[model samples]
Target: MRRQPSMLYLRPFMPLIVGLSLGFTLCLVCLPLLEEGCTSEGSVDQVARLRKPNSVQETQDNPKPAKSGGKQPFRARYISTELGIREKLVVGVITSRETLDTVAVALNKTLAHYIHKLLYFTGTRNVKAPGGMYVVTHGDDRPVWEIAQTIRYINDHFHKDYDWTYLVTDNTYVQGERVTDIFDHISMNRDVYMGKRVPFRDMDGYYCKVGITEKDGTQAFSQACILPLCRGEDVCLFVCLFVTMETILDLQPDEWLGRCLHDVMGISCVGEAEGVDYHTYEFSSTTDPDNEDSQEFQKAHTVHPVVEPTDLYRLHRRFAHIELDLLYPPIQTLNPCFPAQIKNLSHKTPEGEAGLTWPIGINPPFKPQSRFDVLSWDYFTETHLYTCPDGAPKCELQGVDRQDVDDIITTSVQRLNDKYQKQGLTFEHVRLLNGYRRFDPTRGMEYELDLLVGETGPDNIRDVVTKRVKLLRPLSQVEIIPMPYVTETTRLYVILPVTVHDREQVAKFLDSYAQVVLDIHENSALTVVFIYDPLDAQNIQEEDVFGMLKSMITYYERKYPNAKIPWISIKTDVPTQLKIMDIISKKHPVDALFLLVTVTDELTIEFLNRCRMNTIAGWQAFFPIHFAQYSPELIYDTKPYPATVEFGKEFGHFDVHAFDEACFYNSDYMSTRTELQKQRKENEDVSETYNLYEMFLKHSNLHVFRAVEPDLRQRYMPRTCNPHLSEDLYHSCLVSQAEGLASKEQLAKLIFEHDNEIKSQAENVVKS
Candidate 1:
């Protein structure tokens, strides 16, 4: 004969025996009442009791229904009023050594308020924990066995009492009110299963979702267990797993329960396609705290894999805004008679301060980590790590065009002339050094203008003066008097070419440039311009480039609000070197220092200051030879990616011949380059085509200073090495792994020693 299922033992004449005993006892009492001429009300009560027991009578805690002649309407047991949903729901929390504290936090703050018949299951013996938590198990660590025993215990003790039962791991967070609301319309008679559903390994069935644990850069994707919803008796039917345990030992508990209930009892998951199973939010170590008041969080019934005890309490406080009448407190509290000590913990006290919701004995008092912290942290670390001063206000620089600051510059320059009218130092022209508009929370939009005022002497010679002023715009449409401060500062304009192919590299450079400018004192001025060819944007749409720039601008503005790092973008037919220089000359004054570079080049504050101090307007120019990195194919030849270069050797040697890639020149010298370009464009048939290095050599009248800039480095191409080269020099041809260079003192000393030799040689000749 086929073996009967283990669940069949639950119904072995127990129902029949209980029914016969209740009927016999009621009849004996009713006969005595009839002989005593019982009133019509008493007789009606006797007949009502004699009828088949109603749903209310099934649970001892639920109140009796009103007297009625017809049958009562079908009501889901989960929808309760007398004992409320708190008593109707039973939660069995599965815990282990790893999750005891987290489980305690959940029970203390959240689950204890919504579940009365709560049970804790830990299969291990001799575990020290708070009393009335550890359920006795047969010393089996398997989740399948734990789940079976929990269901069997619920069926035997709380059979037909609670309408719903939930079995979840300690890391899972249950929003009790949300679960009740989801099943408010479901009938108690129907068997229901709920959780995040995913395909079981190679099996046709689906099981509740599990999470992965990532530790020390390693990942372990373990299967977790969750059994939710369904009545006590209905869930007990899953204990039949003992009969087929051998064939299904590999299955997770949730998967095993899903298969058994579906295959044996013909019950399919009535969990709605978009219900709790779909709305659960699973968090890991790196997840942000989702807002509880949002509509998405309100719909989610549970949050899983909340392994930290403090995080569990934080989530509880978020959802604790709702005040549900706790008609039935849990049968077991973490501490005995704990409720009497506090009376009742709710959102408000009788005297009405904040919620007296602090849990006892939990370490590190709750501090709110609001969304602003996250937003600001992300802004600072968007591309690189940055440290913000303590108690700094959140601020961002709003991008503005020339027209927006034209009036501010005009007004500020006029104010300066009025202040110095008697001294005969007249301010002639106002050039925008780095004027920017910023939005202040307390005040409306205010303007900070860093204007370069051109002061003309009596001899008609011109010199630049820098004046910084802050102006307040009020609601009365009145202009406030500007406060001015003057300082002698170097002004630099950086130019670079960007394309769709170099978007990522340009983004990294932009971030690094933002950091570089942070080291600049308030007196210095910096602006950057990126030129791109509209026709050459091949890989991505032109709009994508605009979007990337827009986001990066917003991020940097928020992080370094006071630092004047202005940026501009131009679209041209071709971003040629001569064309870019011409654009700069037209927009900026002749004295504005210009440094042309590529996206792969690294920059520093010292290098920028060197360009400013070394390059004299019209008298001298700086042509820095940059250090280049090695080729990946040469160093990691035939090896896999991330291969290391030769030990103790950094990549690349300084190329003394490379001067065209990075150059610092004034607009007067740029005019000569423009003339060369114009001549080339006109005379195409010329045999001798002069390149940039040749142009530098031809302009011998200007003292063109050349030196190796140790701080500046550039990337090398793939074929930078040759196989015929000696093996001793092979290390220089491999990809660079240089995170940092030699100390600043060391590099500065090396550059000074080399530069003095060149300076002495240049003095002997008419150098350019």
Candidate 2:
């Protein structure tokens, strides 16, 4: 069985962290500075709140990045302890490139259609590299004035609270036809469509969502996830384009580009691209300051469809608006021309030289391999050593079937590294990825893994492993503790064989499984078991395997309590009921846990080793989501799906319509607050009116520091809510992954596939 991709990107905000206790989450209907402080009653956020809001309350002058030298219309405000005030400015990761890459191409095409035709984003094209990608307008065209107009218009009509948003573009290896047309049309007539979905539909709302993880650069799709919670006319979209700028002696990245366009820029695009005219706000691009300490508040916009328009808006602003420096206006204003003439570390700031990668968007935090990963895989395969298929990457081992992956990888690296040893830069950063074998189930499985710590050669098992381990992290500060929550309750299937009995007498054997559920540790809510009657089974009680499972669970529990082995039994030897095993597997999507007794005279069992392997892989893929929310325990029954026949004096059934207007009309203030309470629940802060953060809660025990509390499930669901999570994460994670693929120098396809497969499995289960 192929490993399933993760539902890690499935972020359902309405069901996971909607807390009665927490507050201060950004209304991510867009992205950035993902801090969730304890805001006032109106909102609830889960992340850390970064900074205070602008001091000037009447900050009406909005800086038109497109126009250059002007004040912005709105100043972001929130509750801040640093200022001892309510109106503070919070920061969080908006949609990022890595976040965008996971989105499938079909969704990308659909969204491209949405934006291109409406906005005239122009011909969507792709620039590909071995480890990078870029998707943007075919020819050279920027979105400055059009985005400016978009920003101004949105402020004038929709919302005045936030004037800044990120516009994330999609990552596409292939851009289908009609993408540009749809994008262009949307740009001109954004108001034609309601929201991302219709206003009153039972669908996803327009919100910018990002999955934040402290796990740095470990290539796993599950590490970062996202969902959409933003809607807008302006977008700070960050585009990821391939980097092929070796001519400039700059290998910035393989494929990436930061294509920004705010609502202001989109409006500008309308004029320049489509000749649409709107009243231009009398705004200069100068940001005035009275010597407040201001730092470059970095807000990233990843390009992808199904994202908060915030990133695209940013892209619009960055390119079409003004020089990038002004965007980082300090609260304590610093001259863009710093005392020493400010320049970025990469020397690519506004003053720095622009190059082929200028349009490419490869930002910092180059994912250095982690220490855990570096030492996690050691050469520990003592199983078999053999050669691969004839003429296929020729190997020199013994048996053809027994292959040593380490040998193959080692040889490849040695040959390649030897050829490039003359290069000056130390080849210390890169190494081999271990954990590359499947243990045989024939013998008791003892899985052991080790990360390469360096010392590899081209002809060796690996080209290189970590030789010099960097001790950079502050060991004193880094502490870890595991908090176990009530995870999934186990399911049990019993296999009781028929002895000296015909098929009709099988009910007597089936009745015992019901008794088993009642007999096992009842007080523990962590366990649930189901009994199955197999259609193709023939065996007696002693000759059967049902009794062996009881021993396995009993033995495994004592051995690996953490494994949480659940149980299920299959009763075989019945003539017709034997095929039920396939039905149960199909419906529950449960890995083949039940033992199928093949016939009455003898015992034939398909142990389902592959299913077990995939099941375990699925467990890891959704490790975050598994316990992140509540999942109803699914059980297979020997009996058919029983339909409840309700006898009522008056027959009643409600057919729900999409976007029902009646629900809102009947809602009272209390009901509205309740609904808002579910949607925008800010955690405890410092005050009743503005802040709700409780110091104790803010300084939570690190062990319980789930970004989205595992116990909390109301506002947005966790990666596990495949029903909700799959839909959201699928849309969000894949989009972000697309961005990552386009931008990240060396994209990790392994991580993407793992995450995608997990979600696919869950989705197939849901669909089936």
Candidate 3:
């Protein structure tokens, strides 16, 4: 009787009983709890979700927040890009033993550090080294590989990250053979600009045969017609970043050049604060009260690699490429990107029959360009240079000008000596401008290109020289910054601003763009990985930005069915303990996730690979870290979104939360992507949207606002004091009331108190 096993006999009937009773029992017990879990307050009432069906089969799974740690879940800014990114760009030092290697690592690391920060915020830098050599570039105009290097380094090393393509470089890439050569190649050829020569009565010594006739060949009034007929068009600007510890014993001048370019030379290039009478880094030397009070920022510059002890011609040589012609160069049709000019031809293809002249020419882009005079070989070749032949000296040959050589013989030495002679200098002063000769018949052209093989050609020399030629140094600490590449509206800002009249509404999808869009793996669509967003003023509370982001993401996955997606929302605001607390206060309104829970047992508390950390492919929810049991779909919330109480971690906490979705074909999501996009003339009658007045009205709902006081934060916490000390001060503060902790009206009242403080801070930061 005891062996009947408490209902063992019923166990025999258990199959049928379970078949009959379990559904009803679960429906009665589970349905009520789950329905209440989702519909409750302070949750991301995401898009499509489950309603109480008639039976247990439709019950929503509910997982509880892990009790181990006090952590606030994130409001995911939904970002998706189908990618297989290998998160490392091994920047090998390629240095000698321990010491130099350490220096290399430190310099590169410091460079990488500031570059990451600058790019994350401004998306720009003043100087960039796309390859081994340093380069000075406007943030917007940096070479593609340099931009990629910055993006990849940011993605791999920083807590907040970014990504680029395997090969998106246009100017240079792979650091192969020093891509700086490209600039040198472009600058080699030059125009022959002539100016009326001045008499050498004041300046004498440089020798040249001067025989001249007057304007009318009267009175014998002679002057050297100083015409600079430059032909170094193939020349370029290249440089070396000199690095050094002690030039006397250890560092060579060039090494110091390298080090300066590698780790320094950022702020020094421009005068501080526009016209501050101090060195760029002069704010330091605080304890050195006896130090000289500063005045008038000196141009930031490098002192090494001079042709003479006091001469800066080595740098000048590089600078000359740009300095040669303050006026824009004669545009050549071959240089496609340059603007059109009479010389840099306005059109490659001539417009329809422009007042036909005698000696009719074929329309350009054929043989012998239609623009230049056929009789004047020099004009045809030098001005409208195309895929055509203008024969003269070698009229026997193709496109050769025999008279061109004769013109060169007289013009060559005189042109070289002209500009230099005015300054009492001569041909020897020019490093690469050795004498030239006619192009031999052996090669295909009229000019034999000679690269003085003693030393290899320079790379990024112009940029190197540009930044170095202007250093305001000898005072203050140094910092390097990255060049800005992405636009403010386009970066993570793409998804940050969207106010749903109700978070309690079912769900709304938001879209984000990448700094550089990588190709989608399978479909015609792109795999755009969003790297960051400014901290949402609203997300500071409940960080369920992590959650709201989930809905937008569910939307993208649905809309772009064939494209795979991965995304993370990086809150750019630094945080404090109170701020972190504000985030945790509001738990998930509904936390249904596509989690691979099996990995939970092994997660190291604060490791970077945790489910919520930022990366090119979102957080690293690796195999074991994301899963718990061997459950196939171990989710506890409804589909498309989550339950408020279900979004937290069970055994481990993370900087981010992982959400998985197979959600597709969502009509709701599509509507939002095109929300602001106008469809047609018929819709023109629709009322205007995005008005400041409406924004003011919408923002009147104070409960959702988050504020910050800039003056207080900046004065207290700056890594400039001791970068490693602690970032406690930089953290954000959440002043709003906690979810479930306060009524909406109560929260609104508290929010308004800080609104003024926030508004003033925003204004001050802009002013500062």
Candidate 4:
């Protein structure tokens, strides 16, 4: 019927036939290599894999290991110890109906791998939960009560099969590897209830305390004193339980579980302790905005309320990268065909340590490598804290004596009372109620104290009435620590020097700024300053440009009423921007920062923080190297060009060093202008070519040159906005004819060889 099945019919299955033949040939090739009497218990999987090369294989327990093998796709298997943990532990993600989809995404991204017995529970009925999660029939509206019922269900069912149960919310991100290690030390038989323990207060303002007692009802632990309640009622479900709608209604799902467990299982809520310390809570997502760098985030067993799907992915990606690096360290080259050779294998016996294998010549076969070694407790348990360097100026009162602080507070209160009496003020609460310090190095100190003094009645000591008084101290001997003023929260100011060519350019600029403002407003206290001349716009009306700018600002202000969106617009020449900067820096708070960027530049929150940290008052500045794009004419041209294009490909010549657009500096770094003026007079030849970046580097005490990856790609501005030229034609003419004239690699190599010479030349210029 098909003329004996022609070559065309077999062409579709050619890849499959070739793949099978190759796999079979490799197995045949490998089988003869193993010498006689070389077989051992550890070699079974390897032999099996060779015999049936095309067989579908599942990892013994951890089926889907979260190992990122980029070019090498072979995953290291889980060890016996890690597999045992997977069999014993069960994780339940407690979620509400509204956040189920978000929770599912989080679980799949982070915890789905390695955790064998993963389950999720919600309160909505008749709704299909993804990944075979559980759903309850009732109590969907009351999420708090639903959580209580969920716990009871877990304890009833899971305690028999699973040794430990960890319940977290949909938004919580649990570091599974860290959690398992913590559970290894904890005993399932013991009374264990662990979370971030929050002190609970009743409707009547009485604190709830948990008292330990013997089985016979005698108190075994000291009890915290309870405050008196306004309406005394019998709300005790236990020995001391205060329940009210005003109080219990606001209890979060975690708090509700803690209370429910105390009543049902008779165990108190506990936190970090000896041999078991893993739980830490953060109520918000902590992700680095620019690079999604996990190193910047606080190290904890769990980070909670990572509500955004994107944030969950960020945390997962970074954490997975960390694990992958630990497993296959970058120092060692990995082989795709063979198992990784692990040097520090955990299961080595003393005999094996003495270079003895089970068989005569072969080394003991590799079992699936364990990610965490036996002595890796320190890696998981050690806490990382930020500390100021010794001999550095610290903001806190670190070395000062405690008694001296007490004496100062007491003396300041007395002086305030004396002033209050003279002023005939009825504010009698002049005693030291509370006090805090904020430091300004320029001014000595300003201590803001809350003083309380009362007029006692003759009848009873308890009848004494008090009034609150706020005082600032400049009293005879006591010095004050000045705090930041309310209006001085903004630390960085961005200055934009713009030239508008057309309505299209203006629109693009506004759109870019709007996105930047949205990204930064929540996290940063900063302002934007626009420096441009109205007459510079050759295509659009100056008035229309101003109106557009105003509209953008107004829209943001109305949408985010609480956030202060400060935009300062100045119509001036480009050189005048520096003078405005000098004026602003002189008046702004100490260590206030400034940045220079074009209107087209997009900024990230991470870069802004980097700007703040790198720039120190009168000391250092950041002059970031930028990527200069190649000519658009060569890019869009159908004909061959002089140099090869490297824009999107690996090792491709896309960007080159020409101009730097971004500079970050603090108030004290304004010596740039002064130094430039001196240089111009001293050596007129070099002054004309000496740029702002070079001047900043020469004047500042310390200068850091960092390359901005995914750099600020400035839009091309034509020499003239000619009415005859079309938009596309104008773009092509913007790039100079000399550009794309030579290979980028040659230029890069030349620069690299002469880097030292260039530095020496700069130094010589400074000396002159």
lDDT of each: 0.55, 0.27, 0.26, 0.49
The sequence of per-residue lDDT tens digits that candidate 1 reaches over residues 568-667 is 6666643444545555667767667677777777777777777777676655677787776655444343756442222223455565544435444566
lDDT, candidate 4, 1-768, per-residue tens: 676578778889999999999999998888767544454433554555578757676667844334322333344375643454324566766665677767555665577665767766667676655444454444564655554455456555654456666666667667778777766666555656565555545311111222121000000011010111001111222312356666655655444444444444445556543566544544343346324444424355666566676677766666665666567544344653233233234237554445443332333433334654221111000112122334343334333334434555555545554445545433233345445443323222334454455543334243234443332322232334322222223456666544443334544655565566554453444455555564644424545455666576677668667655566655643333344465556655645566766553445555565655655555456665433344444334465543322334222232333333544555455566666666566645332234445556666555545555443444432334233333433344344323433346555655776897899999999999
Best by TM-score: 1
lDDT of 2 at 378: 23
Number of the candidate with higher TM-score, 3 or 4: 4
lDDT of 2 at 508: 27
Local error of candidate 2 at residue 332 (angstroms): 32
How well does candidate 4 score on lDDT at residue 128? 52
TM-score leaderboard ranking: 1, 4, 2, 3
Local error of candidate 2 at 331, Å? 29
Best by lDDT: 1
Candidate 1 lands at a TM-score of 0.29
TM-score of each: 0.29, 0.22, 0.16, 0.29
On a 0 to 1 TM-score scale, where does candidate 2 land against the true structure?
Answer: 0.22
Better of 1 and 2 by TM-score: 1
Between candidates 2 and 3, which one is better according to lDDT? 2
Candidate 4 has its poorest 10 consecutive residues by lDDT at: 214-223
Tens-digit lDDT track for model 3 on 1-768? Answer: 897678666778878887779888878888866875443332332212234444555336764433322234555454432342222211211121222223323333333432312222112454223323222232442222233233334334532222211111111001111112222222212211111122222232111111121100000000110011011111111222232323224422222222222232111111112122111111122312122223311121111111121122222223232334332345333464542233334344374234232122212221334656232212222223222343323224123344443343334434444534545533321122222332222221233111111211233122111000110101123445332232112111111121222232223112211112212221112211222235453555656544655556566677656544444333433322122212222321221111111101121223212212221121111211122111112222335432122222331122111111111111211222134234425454212222211222232221111111111100001111212213321121111111212334544655785697899999999999
Error of 2 at 397 (Å): 10
